[model samples]
Target chain A: MTQKTDQDYILEVRSGNVNAYAILVTKYKDMMFTLALRMVGNREDAEEIAQDTFVKAYTSLSTFKGTSKFSTWLYRIVYNTSLDYIKKKKRVILSEHIDEIHEASIGTMQDAMSYLEAQEKKETIERALLQLPEEERVLLTLFYFEELSLKEITEIVHISYENVKIKLHRSRKKLYHILKNVVEPIYLSHGSRK
Target chain B: MEAENKKLDQFTKEVIQDAGLSSPSVDFLANVMAEVSKEESLVKAQNPLITKVGWMIIASLFAVFTFVLTRFSLGFSILGDWDLSSLMIEKYEMNVDIPITYAYCFFFLLVFVIIQINFIKKYFYRSLKN
Candidate 1:
């Protein structure tokens, strides 16, 4: 496979170049995984959903017609796949284990006074992220991690852009609140520097 | 409201930059690529139209089978006994032993032909008529 542009890659894929699809899968897999992981909150399920998304995108490549950007189409598949998997798994209830992790991060942050502090901060953020409502978590993931614009998020999530904007606003507000209140206090109030 | 909007915008950027949501891991990509390859092979093995036609043929066959089964059971009850006087009376008053395979075939074929003709007429000849 000579390195090809996205359009060329799509064309090759449409023309029955099976190997070309590997390029696309490689390109989008991480973004898809993050999207799925945020939606379902489990790495294994997220990985499975990401794989399903790629397979589905390839099978429905003909229907794409290039109407939307390739990433948009890919995200739509990832979003829908994650949603379907969540429905099947019936894991809507946020588990206590997540809360336990969130609480433990606070305890561990007390003695962290150097390079490990940064790692702890990252873990704290991820833990707080798990506390958000499902829709809020998904919206934040798509908008922030996926770098999808509000309009693109609307298309992928199948909601109005105004609705996306409002939901995104509320989600961000909730996320900030969780970080500031739930995680930040724990870190800031940790025992005075040595 | 403007201040609130600015704060939200700032928060959005901060979150996006901090979250670090990149694409899947390298190993995950490998798994997805393998899955796509398998799917591609399956997709290439058959034409879309052929698959649709195949399903239609299968459904038609199933319908024919169910009709045959139903008719055979009905036949046993309607024409079980085999005697000369039974045949004579059945011939006149509709009570006799008939193999029923012929009737079942005739009924099903009639239905199949009618549906095919209707489909062809609607899809092919109707456009010509217009």
Candidate 2:
């Protein structure tokens, strides 16, 4: 069975088969949910935002002009939807001002990570990710996990490619700053043994 | 410095990929589909049964009929050559013949107004929520 493309399902939807949208929703739901969850940092509100994004996407599907890939367009919608939600709720995410790193050794960070159990690594990364500013979390996730190009992210985030590159760099630096702090104790313990 | 940054970037990428993406509740797909279906229905329902063009056509026909009725006069002009003012006066005179009290009439008018208001409110409630 050849899996239908996103465009195929979209055309079916445009032609009046409303149920065809279920396939597209199922296809993208995980990525959508994860991205929304990362943006909002709460499972319940993340689910709601994901739901609203799908509904908004369906309602305004006609406006899609095929100028970019469907997933890119959908990302743009979810991105804006999350922003609107944050603005409406008057959410104030306390930001830790991250300085540019002068010396944070990757070898020590790797040693600390290998020292921890698998579950601890997962929880530690997620916890630290949640603490970073909202936009950076989104930028890093889209850049690394989704492997979206700078041009695609530029379209979704409405920033120039140069800014996207700069932000992505800073986001990586910020995330490294957070993850390094979590394993700083392990590094110190290894130093005492030496 | 750039080479060091690249190594750190590669390390973060590996660790993040290892931790993996977060999954929503098991019912997330069903929930979003439910909302989508609901939104589809709302859009469908908002399409007025009588389109604006339809209403315009009906209004044009009605105006034509009203004008024809007003100009309607035969060689035999019964009811005073079909004079509209006289007919209106006769209708007013017929109102005087009714046995209803003015207070009852006012009360009934108020009740009908309240009912109409309630009907409009009921019709718009769902749309307002959307």
Candidate 3:
């Protein structure tokens, strides 16, 4: 889908046309939620953070200087708010530990495990994504799902650009190891025996 | 480095496209915008003029109060032996020396004056012009 220029939306929203913000929210909600889901590892918390991010963006709308893309600012709020929620919850959600998830039965994972085996490996990768550390998870989510560049990710997370690169590398490596272990014979044996 | 980078890029692309992650619903955007509108309504309910005037009055009062206090403190000074000679001499036979407390008071008063004057000059010139 062709997205409208952020400048056009910002101008309209700032001029008291709040409905303009709806368009922006629609366009970026997926990107924002995906980032939150990865960091917090729960759909409920991700949805809450996503909603809170928009509310915050609205309240602080006037302070939004036009120097950076509005999406960058929006994503920063999502990342920070999700982090705050994670801290408040005091425990990582169970989804973060699962390395093998049967994709087809995502909706049915709670009822049956055998059904999940028929699903694609992609679901498992998402579950594996949750296993990553906060910094790495955020970097990967932003770079991949959000389609943000290294420089933009640096700005959103308030870290040095080099730090983003380093984290991205380490995180990707960890994700690969986790995914590989799940596919190995040891993992299969454990699953079959269970 | 190049090969690893290519592999990572490929993996990133694959994950984003193929992952079964649910996209945000259209209603989510509508809900957020509705919230923005609600906040806008709340801000609109408050009288901007009254808020600005109230802040201005507070700031002015603080400056005036600070100035008066500073001036009062500055005027108090330590009494000297000669200055108190008549009063002390008449009341008692003790010869005493009293040092003026003006230095500390005056220093503080000067600071208050500087602060007030600076605020007035800055505000009047910038705000009163247009």
Best model number under TM-score = 2
Candidate numbers sorted by TM-score from highest down: 2, 1, 3
Candidate 2 lDDT, tens digit per residue, B1-130?
8878888788878767766777778887888788777777777766878999999999999999999778974556565656577556665666545556877998999999999987886678566536
Number of backbone collisions per candidate: 6, 0, 2
**What DockQ does model 2 achieve?**
0.40
If you assessed candidate 1 against the hidden native complex, which CAPRI class would it receive? incorrect
Task: Summarize candidate 3's per-residue lDDT along A1-194 as a digit string, tens digits.
Answer: 88669788888888877778877887778888888888887777788789889899878978999788888899889989987887888865432333333333232322222323535456777877777777677788778766789999988898999999988877766665565555444445666899
What is the Cα-based TM-score of model 3? Answer: 0.62
Q: Stretches of candidate 3 above 4 Å error?
A: A1-4, A92-119, A184-194, B1-5, B49-130
List native contact recovery per candidate, as a fraction of 1.
0.54, 0.61, 0.49
**Location of the lowest summed lDDT over 10 successive residues in candidate 3 chain B:** B121-130
Better of 2 and 3 by DockQ: 2
RMSD of 1: 13.8
Model 2 chain B poorest ten-residue lDDT run: B91-100
Report the poorest 10 consecutive residues by lDDT, candidate 2 chain A: A95-104
| lDDT ranking of the models | 2, 3, 1
Interface RMSD, candidates in the order listed: 6.5, 1.8, 7.1
Off by over 4 Å in 2: A97-104, A187-194, B51-130
- The deviation in Å at residue A30 for candidate 3 is 0.8
